[model samples]
Target: MSIRQPVSVKFILTEQTKQQILTEQRRQIEQLTAEMDQIEQQGKLALEQAMTQGGSAAQEVRQQIEQERNQRMEQREQLIQQIQQIQQIQQLELGTELQNMTVETMVDVNVGDDWGMVLMGSEIIIKDGIVHEIRRGGQPV
Candidate 1:
């Protein structure tokens, strides 16, 4: 505790050094801006060339996109039609089979207005062999 010791200190950038660093950063930013401008110009030139050369490439790509869209739409329509056709066929087949089954009596049954007849047995209620109702199991006939 007799002699005092000097405290160690870290060096910091002076104002001149800070100014130099800022100048370098500005120079780098200007260089990058110039490069970006050059790249954009090159892209524009390429697009111009593509446009001048008959423009067939772009047209072909557009046609391909349109064709693919049409194909998908056609496929979707076909699928929907197929589903509808299958449903119709199933309904017709079931109705035919139901009409072939015999019922004990056709009492309390109307040609087209009997909910009880429509829910009873595996019978397709036919006025004259024309299907009026489709039924399953035995509820009421």
Candidate 2:
């Protein structure tokens, strides 16, 4: 039997091949740089257009938003004033109701209690059946 040997080959670059590869790499880099520059220029143009053409629109929107906020604040203030007026009316009604009640006596429930029974004058103020402010002997208590 006869044995055959296979041939092995090695590749090497000459100066021309090396220069060709470098030129291709430089061309690719230049192409990519040109593409990036074009994209940046387009972005700048778009931004300038938006700032110039849409400026008045943006200002109008901002003014509308501010006006709405002021309106809401005014409404809230009016509502708060109405609530205060209502509370004042309620207090007056409570005072009138208390004035109608008559206290028969001011007896001390406990003999040695620190808080003795309070004496009510001719006029008194009450809310929810609880005495809040009172006048004793024509003086506020």
Candidate 3:
């Protein structure tokens, strides 16, 4: 039988990787800022229209817009924090491994298989967009 397993993907810190991460983070920040601005403009127009129609309706619309704005603000803050963390990572010595993401793979299972080893999971170390090493149970494979 075949079983699915989760594996961790880690990155070995390098100058190139650091800059790539920073670029992506900054792009996300820009997108969020643009979205926030768009929301403000659209909300203001809608609110004004509602106000002309009814005061109570306008108040409700304003609340909804505020809620959406708050959500965007929180997301922006988180992205900023991630950018800061990436900057800190740059200060670490090269080859320092940081968990980047996760992926799934399939493994063939048979009777009497070592469950401990099979379930121990795996990790792939990447450097400069290439696979540097693969480890299973903390041992290079």
Candidate 4:
């Protein structure tokens, strides 16, 4: 029988990869800031439109806008922290491994197979956006 298993995909950190990460993270921060600004403008317009309805209606709109603002703020903070972390990664020596993502692979499981070895999982080491090596059972394959 064959079953799906998760394999670890790791990156061997290089200057190129670091810069790519930093660039992507900074882009996200810019996008978040723009969204926050647009939200504020829309909220102000909404408040003006709701004012004629009644106090309660405007209050509800205010609350909803506040909630949206809070969520976006939290997301922006998280991105900032990630940017800091990437900066720290920049300080690390080249070729250090970083966990990139997980992917599933199919493995053949036969009767009497050593379950531990069967489920040991695998890892693909990437360098400069290329697959450098693969390991299974902690040994290069």
Question: In order, what lDDT does every prediction score?
Answer: 0.45, 0.45, 0.92, 0.93
TM-score leaderboard ranking: 4, 3, 1, 2
| Residue range 50-82, candidate 2, lDDT tens digits | 567698755655555455556545655655565
Worst 10 residues of 2 by lDDT: 2-11
What residue runs in model 2 are displaced by over 4 Å at the alpha carbon?
1-53, 94-141
- Report model 1's TM-score to 2 decimal places: 0.30
Instruction: Please identify which of the two predictions, 2 or 3, would achieve the higher lDDT against the true structure.
Output: 3
Q: Per-residue lDDT for 34-116 in model 4, tens only?
A: 99999999999999999989999999999989999999999999999999999899999998999999999998889998888
Best by TM-score: 4
- Of candidate 3, the 10-residue stretch with the lowest lDDT total is 86-95
Best candidate, lDDT: 4
Q: TM-score of the candidate numbered 4?
A: 0.91
Instruction: Tell me the tens digit of each residue's lDDT in model 3 across 11-124.
Output: 998889989999999999999999999999999999999999999999999999999999999999999999889889878898789889999988888999888888898899
Model 1: per-residue Cα lDDT at residue 28:
55
Clash pairs, candidate 1, are 121-137
